[model samples]
Target chain A: MSWAWFHKLGSPKWFFSWSKPWALPLFCFGCLSLLIGLVWGLVFAPADYQQGNSFRIIYIHVPVAMLAQSCYLALGAAGFVFLVWQMKMAPVFIKAMAPIGAVMSLVALVSGAIWGKPTWGTWWVWDARLTSVLVLFFLYMGIIALQNSLEDQVLANKAAAVISVVGLINLPVIKYSVVLLETLHQGPTFTLTKKPEMPAEMWLPLLFAVIGLYCFVAGVVLWRMQSEILMSEHRSSWVKQEVTKHGF
Target chain B: MAFNSLTEFLMMGTHGVYVWSAYGFSTLTLVWLVWNTLATRRKTRDTLRKRFLRNQAR
Candidate 1:
């Protein structure tokens, strides 16, 4: 693939300005879609014949679990970019994404526990899927703590990048944990490789929720990225001009 | 709607506590994360702009 456009993305000023127009709209769309999906999934969608209304939690749980894993993948990819191309924005992306990923992982874990109590009759069990996800949460916390512990920004980014990449090995394990082991956790309701084992009525809102969550994550990242760019590049001429232009 | 009334929806059949707690926690996470990031961004920008202006005066 051509590398020219890829390098252009390295420029924070260009990205900050280029992403501005769509970011707000995307966030609003995410909010709107999530609201609709939640209402549809919780109120209108038929209750599970087995799990009953407890299955309503799936609308939130699945989206967040997917986001937690997806964000880690993103962190790993950004780490790779930082290590290889030394893209300035890549490290900034890693820093910005870590907390967001951590929170999502936490929500996934907590929601899983909540969902588990009613279904499994316990708050937590050392099931394969649950354990792997707990590990994911810890990995996210490790990246955040590691980034903060270092004094030198560049060195910190580099060290964290290595950790992120190494942790990328866990992604497949988390995804396949249920299939590979005897897990109390249910199998994937939505899989890209094959038709989901859920009805259209159930999976349809789930689709919306996933897309909405992704959009939400993207918008929040861009929001933080713009702020990160401004703060980091405050002394740069472009940032100075923008500050004056915006009367900030 | 799956339930017959507002009360039924709140009850969520027999699993009301689990359902509500999960949703409540998820909502809190989403709200708090977004709020904290925006707050941090605003504070950083304000502080940076202040420093920039002070530098300009010197």
Candidate 2:
């Protein structure tokens, strides 16, 4: 593929128009996969021999927890794009992604806690995995706060982008903290470096959920990016013609 | 396949509270994310519309 497409992506109008057709179908597919994954995991999958029904929490917990860290990395990537290319749309993406990432972190933390209560016999723990995830949550919140606090949108994006890049240092620490610290938390249940011990039946739905969540995240980001483009390009002739064409 | 009856599924074999709460919270967060994105888009479009009209009238 030509690298020319990457350069074209820097244009807000071009990106907005390109994303329009894919948004609806992607969102629909995401919803469908999520529903199927939920049903398959929650009802059809055999109960864990040890945890029994409580294991169902894995369906939501694993997906959101994975998203929490991945979304931060995404924000950091957007920050790099913003800084290097000075893409007008990059900041908008960073701004829109902040809250969504924060919410994902929140869900991950809360669901983990709930899962812990039944599995670990406590609602809270200072385990490396748990603590690192909490830090991730706070980092997401800090980025969001920084983005909204600045009056100038450009400055806000720059500030948040800086924070996002700094916070990315924590993702590795979160992932490896368990191993490096030798804490109470167990080793990774899923990892690129090791084979997963989970049965196919159990992991299949989790796989679906993870893929679905990714599509959903992309859909949300595209929709938000389009809005950002409209706001930033409000005075541009293309936006005027586009809006008039859409009767909006 | 996991539960024997509807009640058993609802009860989640006495793990109902935690299981239900996790699902409920996940659903709530997803809904909130969708609503926030849609609302932001609407607000942006409205602001652009107003600006376009104001400039046109001038």
Candidate 3:
């Protein structure tokens, strides 16, 4: 296979132009899917045997939780490329993503806690899975804080990259914490190898929710990346022309 | 529909508090993120355009 596409992706200009066509469509898809999932899960899906109606929280909780973890993993990947190849776009990617990741982590933690109240009989716990996700939230904060604090952009990027890459160790810990350690949290609900613990009617809407949330996250990420591309390339002729073309 | 009426849907069979809060908070957060991204993009474009114009006059 050819690596030309990968190298092309490294070019901010190429990526900005290339991404223009798909971003809005993806956002619309997210909104539509979200509507479908919400209606289905709320009005159609059957209640859980144990958790009762409270299980409805899973529709948002699972998807946002996945987004939380996925964002950090993506940041680490970008951080890796930044450190190794010194890819300029990598730092922009990081800058764009950390806030979204932080927010996702926060939403996951809060919603999980709320879900816990009726199910687990408490608002918070020091369980391995929950605690690791907490750490993930802090790690995202550290990246954003570290980036903002340093006056020198290069120094800031280097430090943030180090922190992001190192924090990658926490991802696996978060994922396996329930299984490897005794915890209030449940094990995987929807895994590839095993049949879902949920029945078709219950999990089917969940599938739509998950896909919708992924699309939403992707759209927002692309939106921020586009901004980052514009900001970083403000001095370039194409950016000037591009900005003007947009009636800005 | 899972519920017999709108009131039952709202009640959520006594789990309404927990379920509604989760959905409310999450949906608000996601919407806020989208709005913020657009606002930030607009701000960046204006600042950069102003700088470009200022440089041109110099």
lDDT leaderboard ranking: 3, 1, 2
TM-score of each: 0.97, 0.94, 0.97
The worst-scoring run of ten residues by lDDT in candidate 3 chain B lies at B47-56
1 or 3, which is superior by lDDT?
3
Which regions of candidate 1 fall more than 4 Å away from where they truly are? Answer: none
lDDT, candidates in the order shown: 0.89, 0.84, 0.90
TM-score preference between candidates 2 and 3, better one: 3
**Could you give me the TM-score of model 1 versus the true structure?**
0.97
Q: Per-residue error at A233 for model 2, in Å? A: 1.2
Off by over 4 Å in 2: none
Model 3 misplacement above 4 A: none
TM-score of chain A of each: 0.97, 0.94, 0.97
Q: After superposition, how far is residue A36 of candidate 2 from its true place, in Å?
A: 0.7
TM-score for chain B of each model, two decimals = 0.91, 0.92, 0.90
Give the TM-score of chain B in candidate 3.
0.90
Worst 10 residues of 3 chain A by lDDT: A239-248
Decreasing TM-score order of the candidates: 3, 1, 2
Which tens-of-lDDT digit does each residue in A136-228 have in candidate 1?
A: 999999999988999998899999899899999999999999888988999999877899888888989988998999999888888877888
Highest lDDT, which number?
3
DockQ of each: 0.75, 0.77, 0.77
